[model samples]
Target: MDEGANIPQYKLFINPFDLKELKRDIWIDDPIPAQLKVDGKRLEIDISYRGSHIRDFSKKSYQISFYKPNMFKGSKQIHLNAEYKDPSIIRNKLSFDFFSELGVLSPQSQHVLLTLNGKFEGVYLEIESVDQHFLKRRNLPTGSIFYAVDGDANFSLMSDLDKEIKKSLELGYERKFGPATEDFFLQEFIIKINTIPVPEFEKEIPKYVDVDKYLRWIAGIIFTANYDGFVHNYALYRNRETKLFEVIPWDYDATWGRDVNGKVMEANYVPIEGFNTLTARLLNVESFRRKYRNLLEDIMKKQFTLEFMIPRAEKLLQLIRPYVLQDPYKKQNIDQFDQELEVISNYIKERRNYLQRKLAKLN
Candidate 1:
């Protein structure tokens, strides 16, 4: 297969012993030393396999971290998603872009061809890491960031895994940035969300959270129909300047008419009122409910239409088609890949109709 000049190529050179060790212990977060050659430049890097269930897949996702003072396109770290389950291989990128368009802070992503030790790996979605660097790049203030590692990250006093009381408020989150003391703030915020009365909660919630930004994030998740998004698959950023928490999306490949396993999901699988204690509490307030309703209606009328979404999906599909065809890992699902635009188009029409019908409930 001819290497497309338009697609960025990343060549990773790792010691054979380290590569074998990495594969043997895919669950380890420890990165092994490597060199990344891109655009005629070679730089030192540490690489590791990323994701939970995806590690078991034949094609694996990777996390790349550049050594201090050395960065890749202004990012200290990046994620290379194989997108093995996503036939379109653009759902994650498309979802992130859609969130950004909705006035939500989302990671920037692009497609790149990756080769391991000179052997073509496949097309990968290069995702910007959400860390201090991400905030700096956007000129946002220094803050704490926590990744929702599992469903227990849901803002509830009870554990999502088991119906028992959680021992700690910070059960499912992993702190990716900031000092350990920041955990207290996150715990306190969750405590307030689950314990405070509706009247006081409504007035005090805005002091801790960016309400408009949170609602916009809900709209993005609901529009994309990411079932896991309500419980996990997100990062929370607490801006030190504003002292308010904001959300950033992550791992959105299982969206837009598909479940985590890449099976077709019903358009109305997720309700207009999203899940999670925080979301429920916020929407219970009349003002917040009204704002969410208006936001959804406005988005449907403007951005979520077939005319707007189809063209975007088509363009992304066209750009990746050449590379996807040449990917040995994607051979079996080539037919599914070719039909993804139709799948996405149908999902948009159905999902829009479903949301339109359910929008009245918000009033």
Candidate 2:
């Protein structure tokens, strides 16, 4: 990886004997072993085709977990996000950079050229995996990491249909770290998040959660227009220091003027409040509401402006344009890719106007 120009090209070599079967069912229980050669160095890795909607796409995304560290920036796992739905191929990168710039913990991402068996596999957004390594690198306190597996993982208590489902692991939390014994306690945390009385929650929530950071995270999601992230596309980490859960954004290819299913998102699609139960509850608290409004106003003034982002977007487009054109398996043509960049620029402008109008209406 170049310090000045961080994007790196990776070449993957896989044995032909297992290619047919592996490609046929890439999302199997076991990871397929392959040799990844990058920058004149070879390393062993367990690569698997990952994602639900994207798994069926012509250009497949991959989850690459190295058997040994130092293969790629001293990390154990990373995602080669196939920006299949995103014609611009920079939405995730743009949104992730926004979060990181705002002092929030977000996955580090870069554009990378990928080739499998010497065949181009399109330009992929290489994203940092938010696992144990992520926590350690950021010096965040180690605790249970829960990924929102399905729509049921929405923070609303109504999402969980069964009251008897005591196992936190089964409650759609999908514990990625910490002890298994913490499952019962983790379930209790979910219950508190969902069912706690508003008055009590307002008073006691801070003991278990950082309301300020949470509001900022929600603001980031709103700014990026990541509707999927509000409910299901996030990671909730139990902060051992504060003993409160912190929200981390995930699966951002759906963001920045587009939904996960590739539909255009309206500039004002997400309301300032009422996006979800957690947000609604937080906004009900006067202090949190004030802080959230301030955050949004500040972000629009300092961060969300097109002046700050357009050049970066153009640079990213410049970096990935050739790869997109050369990728035979890409879903969209080169013209569509260029058009998507225009659409993204227009979205930033329209969204800024919508937000300014919406901010004025807030009390």
Candidate 3:
């Protein structure tokens, strides 16, 4: 087992459970028995496989949706992110912290020492699930919530038509609220953005999407260099009052100088133009492009500096260091942990310079 942190440790016990079934790449509809001990309280929970990729591997992640609401810190559900592919094991939590600190509506994350059925499961990042509870707490209006599961959620014209016609769940979006299982509201929303003329699109877009939040979200992704986030790996919701779609970020393990597969990425890998057709079209408007460029410059100047980031990274590294070294399921060598942090610190410096150069050419 890993050394315990001063923070609350999550002790989960699964009983009458099939270990083989838990390791399979499928979500069993049935709830498996589990006991959760946290913050001096013990609660029973039903756990299940919650991710598309990590489930297929030996090291697993899970969704802990409590049998009762508010069972855990008023959150109905939380994600135990194994972070198997992240050598540093800090990118997801750090990127999220960066966003939240910048006042963006992003998920909150904390590091937890996890033990499953008496065995250490590594240092997992416990992330707040973007559900009804999350929206209520932030005072954000909620209508329908959809998660982008794969590349098909790229906000392209063709993908929009296919979703409307086929209503394929495999099109990479699953509604978490407000809409029925086969709702076309999300599909139609995408079609509206993809088909409308640029001028009309710009005019009507605010009716369906929060342009400021969307720009800031994209700016954060560009600064963080999260390749997976552009087309997928986010949650989109519509506000009933505004009837506008907004987004919250999710699944950030593959960020901050690494690809989704954990390979080292070039410091200048991401361009200032950002990713996805949505950003490209928005940037086509000169005013919008200027605003986006200003956002990048402001983030680099004000928030994402080494003085601000390094200490936070150091503190988290210290907090989870013991657990990471002791966890039996960790994929990276103990030495790589420090190495990865240094790489990220350096990437931050290089990325700032790269963005400065790109912003200079924006005119």
Candidate 4:
């Protein structure tokens, strides 16, 4: 890729000693001191390897936290996704764009070139961190954010890992924002969703969660075919004004016709109803189910079509093609990368048809 390409160029300068220590223990969550130069500005940052399984990959993803009062685009932290498994490399960005278009809150992302000590690392997706800064930048109401770290993040009273009763209601979630005392809000919300009587649940659920936003998020996941989204790969935000929790999507590279492993996932892999205790309980209610059905039907007609999505996919692919060609990690997969547009286009067509057939039977 041309050094002067339109894409952002981020150069990291880490001390050899710190770099060695970081590589020595990839599993550790500790961040080492580093310097980042982007857009001609250099700033001190604390960098750490990010992700669970991907940590083992040759090309690793990174999480960078800016020092106090120093930020990038109003975000104190950011994620640099290696996007190794994704041939297209745009799936994560595409999925996030789709969610935002569908009226769901999602992180903003862009493609960029990354370098370490002046050596080309590869093309990366710079994702905006969904934290207090995220909320502030959007001018949205202040809220507490919690990251669903694993399958256990499923809103079930029973653990998905052990299939037994949970010792703590907040087992799977890691709080990213909010005061310590505010933790009860999520715990109480979980308790209510699980323990409320069916008839009463229909009335009470809306008080704790923004049902409309939640359903839109579910719709985004269903259409994108993010199989893990229901159980995890999401964030919960408790809105201060409404006192309702809203779901936000996270880690969606395993979407849009691909699984987390980058395998070809069938268009119909994820059911229209979706999974998870909160979703099941919501859909059980007559009103919420109808609302979800209507929302899906509307999205099918407007947003999830080939015409609407293909252009967006093409644009992203075009923007990153040059960078991908020069990427040391992904250059070998050029053939596969070139074919992602067709792969994505086909998924949209098949997914829309599947959803259409399923929507009619929703009731």
Query: What is the TM-score of each predicted model, taking all chains together?
Result: 0.98, 0.92, 0.91, 0.98
* Candidate 1 TM-score versus the reference: 0.98
In the range 1-363, model 2's lDDT, one tens digit per residue, is 122245577888778865666787756746778888777778888888888878888888888888754446758888998888887889998988988877777888988888888777767888899888899888878887888887667665565446444343345668888888757666666567777787787887777667887887888888888876677788888887778888888888877788877788888887766366678778877877888889898888888887888888888988877667677766347887787767787889988888888875557
Candidate 4, residue 283: Cα displacement in angstroms equals: 1.0
Write down the lDDT that model 2 would get.
0.78
Residue 260, candidate 2: how far off, in angstroms? 2.0
Question: What's the distance in Å from true for residue 15, model 3?
Answer: 1.4
lDDT of 1 by residue, 1-363 (tens): 566678899999999999998988778999999999889889899999999999999999999999743787898899999999998999999999999999999999999999999888889999999999999999999999999999999989999999889999999999999999999999999998988886798788898899999999999999999998988999999999999999999999999898889899899998989999999999999999999999999999888999888899999999988888889899668899999999999999999999889988988
For model 2 the local lDDT of residue 298 reads 88
Question: What's the C-alpha lDDT at position 177 in model 1?
Answer: 100
Top lDDT hit: 1
- List candidate 4 segments past 4 Å from native: none
- The predicted structure with the larger TM-score, 1 or 3, is 1
Which structure is stronger by lDDT: 2 or 4? Answer: 4
RMSD to truth, every model: 1.1, 3.0, 2.8, 1.1
What are the Cα lDDT values of the candidates? 0.92, 0.78, 0.78, 0.91
For model 4 the local lDDT of residue 172 reads: 94
Worst 10 residues of 2 by lDDT: 160-169
> What shift in Å separates residue 11 of candidate 2 from its native position after superposition?
0.8
Residues 1-363, model 3: lDDT tens digits: 644746458998876445555655365655565778887778878788767767766677878878744457778888988888888778899989888766678888888888887887778888999888888878877677888877778777545435544355237687787758425767677777677798776677677678888988888888888877878879888887787788788988878888888898887777778767777788888787888878777888888899988888888888887787787776358888878768888889888888877886666
